[model samples]
Target: MRTKFFIFIFTGIIFAGGLLLCSNIKTKEIQFEPRQEFSNEIKISKTFKVKPGYKLIVESDIADVSILSHQNDEVDVNFYASGSSKYLKDLKVDFEEGEGTLTIKVKRKREFKFFNFLSEWGIEKAELKILTPQNINAEVKTAGGDAHCEGLKGEISISCAGGDIKLKNHTGSARLSSAGGDIIANDINGELEAKSAGGDIIVRKLSGSIVAKSSGGDVKVELINAMGESEISTAGGDVIISAPSNLNAYVDLNATGGDIEIDFPLKLEKKNHDKLKGWIGDVKTGTKIKASSSGGDIEFRIRKGEI
Candidate 1:
């Protein structure tokens, strides 16, 4: 029994010494030739003579993209990736061209950390920049960056997981959705739809129909003309509407727990608890309007001569 015990202890010590020696051995550095970091700028300029009724789709993570209109008939694209050389080089961005569909995407890699202590040190990745053409239908999706587009005449759709969205001077139908940031749109001439989970929404110069819903912020809309209908709803902030003098549309305001105020061309009579039923002027047959909130105030202003 003593001999067996001695052997077991000796084996354990030998194994531990081997492990210690192996741990102390230096690991080969993953050498990157040139060692220089990658550029933060990615610029792309391309022109496409595409016919009408086409679509462009862009998908990215950690990038900000913008699209604008131009007088030329050709399409243009520009992009810049902001990251380390290894990270950027590892990304594979490719595009597919179709008769009416253009798809752009980035390939991502898996990164692993071996030590828990190293994992505790926060590391922030950089984003990219993308600029696309104008006058074309577009759909953009980003995971962790902001997106802005302006002066587009075709239909537009944008989805951001955790960044702000800004749109201006859009003449066609548009849909904007964000999961973690604010949404702002201005000078929109066509239909508009927007939703946010944790930020405010501001819209101005709306000409057609609009629908905005938020769960955690305010909603403000300034309407220049209402060709069809409009609706705005929120769960945690106020709702404000500013309509033009020529606005001749139906207005519906509802707030479950906030005050309802309406300023119209004609006088309004208090109908019920936090509710009012009145029209400033003759509304069109297809006009539909609604402003609702669950925990904030509601205000509607109708400019003079809006009848």
Candidate 2:
């Protein structure tokens, strides 16, 4: 069901701007047209004093997007477009008054060309900036672009198709997913569930439960202090973690094709399998630490006297 939903979203994005897809352009037939306008910057600023109970949904195919929270209850959006004018005309920003949600989208025409056509269309990048309240339940989707968020206090869901994903200084339940892009997050204060398909994943300074998985990238996790359970997995990269010295929990480490190294104050009682067990110092630590890898080595290290 989830996969179906993702498929629908992807389809909607491909058809977003109401533009038709072009057939393959032969490289020999491609010509640089000086008459075709190629660059533009469009900015939009709007404010919404939303009521206490409502959800905000934002969708885009933007080159890049950043969403941050502020002290007030209003939202301001600034969007820029740099591309073929024929394509930019289809992009639109939608919003409503009263208690309705906000949806932002960019519609671009897909261009296909034969071999050597890549030389004609140079690199084009656009950036969109969004600012909203600190407490908002929102979902963001971007294709061929980066998505970033910070200082959020409610549920956040972000997905990217082919760019980096970043979350900074957020304090709420989050669901982050990406394909063909790196993910970097930090300063989380609630449950975090993140997945990546073909890039690196890094999370630091989390104080809540975490469920992180990656398919083709390295995974790095660092916790200054934690108060919840964690389950992290990776299939094709190294897994590294750093935890507090006075950590507490039932730790589990597994690696299919890698080495395992853990630094704890005390040794865990062996589990009789190809794994190690025991406690660092006191068995009353509050949380459990578990690290696993499939094709790399693992290391678990302790700070100092915390054992």
Off by over 4 Å in 2: 1-35, 96-100, 109-123, 271-274, 303-307
Residues 1-307, model 1: lDDT tens digits: 9999999999999999998877766554455578465444344555566666578788975566766666666566666555455455555566788878878775454453444223212223434333445657888998767888887788899999999999998888999999999999999999999999999999987888899999999998888877776778999999988887655666667888989877666434446667765566774443668889998999887644221
Task: Give a tens-digit lDDT track for model 2, residues 1-307.
Answer: 9999999999998886344433334323676768556665456677766754356676765558898887777788777765566545645666555355666665444543354334224325567788888777778898668999998788889999888899999888999999989889988888898899998889878788888889998888777766677888888988877777777767778877777777665665665333655665568667776677788766665533221
Inter-residue clash pairs, candidate 1: 42-79, 42-80, 44-78, 245-306
lDDT of 2 at 293: 79
Model 2: per-residue Cα lDDT at residue 89: 63
lDDT of each: 0.76, 0.74
> Where does candidate 2 have its weakest 10-residue lDDT segment?
114-123
Q: Estimate each model's TM-score.
A: 0.76, 0.78
CA displacement after TM-score superposition, residue 199 of candidate 1 (Å):
0.9
